[model samples]
Target: MVSEMSKKREFKDDEELEHGKVVKRFNGLPQFNLQRFCYRHNPDVQSSVGSTTCYKQDANRLKSVNDKISQLPKNEREEVHHVVSTFRKSNDKLRKLMLEGILTACCFPQLSYVASEVQNMIRIDFISILPQEISLRILCYLDCQSLCSAAKVCRRWKTMADDDRVWHRMCEQHIDRKCPNCGWGLPRLHMKRARNPTPTRCTELITPWKAIYRDRFKVECNWRKGQCVIQEFKGHMDGVLTLQFSSRLLFTGSYDSTVAIWDLCSGRLIRRLSGHGDGVKTLYFDEQKVITGSLDKAIRVWNYITGECISTYRGHTDSVLSVDSYKKIIVSGSADKTVKVWHVESRTCYSLRGHTEWVNCVKLHPLSFLCFSCSDDTTIRMWDIRTNACRRVFRGHVGQVQKVIPLTIIDIENLVVDDKQTSDPPTDDPHDPLTEDLPYPTHILSCSLDNTIKLWDVKTGNCVRTQFGHVEGVWDIAADNFRIVSGSHDGTVKLWDLQSGKCIHTFQGKSLQEPHDQQAETAPHKVSPIACVGIGDSEFFTGDEMGYVKRYRFDTT
Candidate 1:
């Protein structure tokens, strides 16, 4: 019996060992080895042993503990179970903390990058961070008024906004193609001062583009609102026939047989050019000389600055009605039913014979290569100066053709070529030859006694559009890219949209007490016929038969 009992005890021990082996493989800890249990379960402990060996030992220890618990009394077993459950809960909490720490370490670099990007965005300054060239490019998109308002934002912006390059672009857009001060179709001086300054005669009076644009804007506002400072230039004894304006000077020719030069700003008569023996029918002037045609069958050239007669050429058989000049070449049209091209230096003349009746107006192309003349023969003719032959004859006007002026073109092959060759740094200049090629009326604007104004494409020799609003004969017309202004014997000044061929507004002389207070909706006043018209940057000047020169500002309001 003792031998059997000993054998049973050995068998029980072998079973316990086998059970522990199973637990060691399946569970994380071993059964009932106190040291192994404490080492595996302690949250503060770290093992240097291989992980698999440690896990096996821990499993065996746990199984031994569970076996001991099953062998104990039920109450003691329950108490031991409660202690194990508490340890497991503590271990789970510790595991969660460690997992969180590991995850944070792994994500640290990415989190740091995100934080830096956010900070950079918060500190960014557009004007300061961007290069000046890029900043100017962005600002260029704003209109004149908006750009001026942007200048008041801060000192940095103000400095950039005041750049001559910026203002130069604005000036090109708003100002006339010709420079007011220099009288050059394209000003020769640099639009913006170069990094290295080049000496030129006009560079000293470099166009103040910023000031020019600002003043022009103010003047435009005055025109739109009918708020103008009217200065009546009254010195003519008879009817004022033709007038031309420079920046500071005004020249007028009249039936009084005299031509008067006035200081435009001061309204003072600077000098009287008085050599014409009969009524001065028409006149043309540039920076150097003033040339006038007279009813006395003479063309007189005068020094505009000194008011001295330089020379007189008498060739026409009848009254000289209109004259134009470029350099030393003079082109005159007469009631003698002929056109003459003269070389002032050589005293040589070439008579162009085409018109069967009186020629009323003649204009030389900017390059002096072509001449345009309108005559009572009801034809508008373009003459080739080099060959002295009529090239194109426009014949749309039923009545006598009154006036013809060149319009801006989409591709201005003629005017722009001369402008580019004569101007500096053809690209940056506000007078860029390409600018005149914008989609505007770059043809010929002609009015007639037929009470119609026609836009004729000189290249195609076709009438593109015809505008009709005047009740009487359309006496005179002036145009820019945007609008065409016409003056008529109807005693009205009409503004027409060049693109739409629509009359957008009308100014009646009879409705005005004076040009300044003439409201669009006011009652009509007694006025005389408009004999002549002159268009400026923001204003237009009209001369009546009564010898009154009325300056009208453009007002939208």
Candidate 2:
């Protein structure tokens, strides 16, 4: 309720004086007054801190003020209250004048008392008072650890810190790409619904973005610390050669001329797919079908669901070395010294023939409509699938190129590599961004019989970085946004940081033990080469020459 004096007094509406013709409201701030309270201590606003206990300094100030007031006579206390109430209702200029007059009348000891009290009272809860938009903008600048700490401050803080919009920005910084500030990148979640951070209307129920970020962050930490449990799968009669996996199952191809599918959760054989006439050398699969290439010189498509061979494609006269596909387009590399792109629906086959020696790897990058092939000829070629013409040739490897993986490396030029010829990788800043606007892949990772893994700049066709860890040849390698997993002829598996090009962890070869055996064997088993490798969201699989596959699971939960 307004006092009668306030009701009678006329005050001017807030407006800015025009030095020019146009006039405007004084500011965008809400209309307010100093009587009941204002910016300093508004009755309408909640207490700054949410906890039940008062802050120590605030409690001390309150105790001292109450002590002084209680000591005064009843009549003097009423006079003091009137003076304080008048000061609270005064405008800024009047209050400052009143403060100066009070200070002038005080002696040194009194001035010292006022100074100490003012110091304790000056601090404010700015994040709580600022408009939410400005508050969130301030929070956005904080890193993950700092942001998480802020969430524990209070209920209001937790709501703002765990906001979907804030977590969405966090995901955008670290998902499928390295964050420039922290040098950390998280694996992209396979589920499109959760990973796709699309904006929603205010009325719509938003996804739990902070939870998604937390789970992925845990997996990334496991990868970095090399914390994992190893599970071995054994059944093939000959050397295990290639493997791939989904969220729930693991697939392996072997020199036994068969493909094996195992339940990843149960660690049991789900199916034994037997159709290839010779050793299965390479394979790729999705939810619908499994495509395998064999030393028998044929590419076979199987309906793994029913354990049936849906189709057989025989065109290469020599052993099929590698295979990859997208849509109806199947690309195959062979000892016939060629890479074949088969459009199954159109019944058309286009041959890419620049490689002089056996083509060892074929990779299809569907997004750019391009195919990458590395060969024993010591060259990696990027081909335009639409034209069947080799767009560029990368020539640097001294030995056969065993694998080629097209990649989108963030800040590819920053990594240090050892290529023997150049003792150091270039630390020069990246070239123009427009030069990187090409539809083709940004970089390529290739391992060779040369016993080294190389990172290449796709646009410049130059080997930018080389990783050397395996004492023998790096036969096969797999990579994701965060790290690289390589299986080598040295009878070891190595994990690498893709960003830094540094070897992080290495596992020595170990033989599988019989699960049914009652007595454990004390004898040491023979070590064999790791011929193939596959990587998933929180795990990686290595298939060795002894017909054994090991799954390294990194997720703690």
Give me the candidate number with maximum lDDT: 2
How displaced is residue 260 in candidate 2, in Å?
A: 0.7
The reply for model 1, stretches above 4 Å from the true place, is 1-132, 145-212, 224-226, 304-307, 366-368, 410-442, 497-504, 510-526, 553-557
The TM-scores of all predictions, comma-separated, are 0.62, 0.79
Which regions in candidate 2 have their CA more than 4 angstroms from the true location?
1-36, 46-60, 68-91, 94-119, 192-207, 411-438, 511-526
Q: Model 1: per-residue lDDT, tens digit, 280-393?
A: 988898888889999999999899887789988999999998898888899999999899999878879999999999998888775536788999989999887888988778
lDDT of 1: 0.70
How big is the positional error of residue 179 in model 1, measured in Å on the Cα after superposition?
18
Instruction: Provide the lDDT at 408 for model 1.
Output: 58
- Candidate 2 local lDDT, 290-339, one digit each (tens): 99999999999999999999999999999999999998999999999999
Task: Tell me the deviation in Å of residue 151 in model 1.
Answer: 6.0
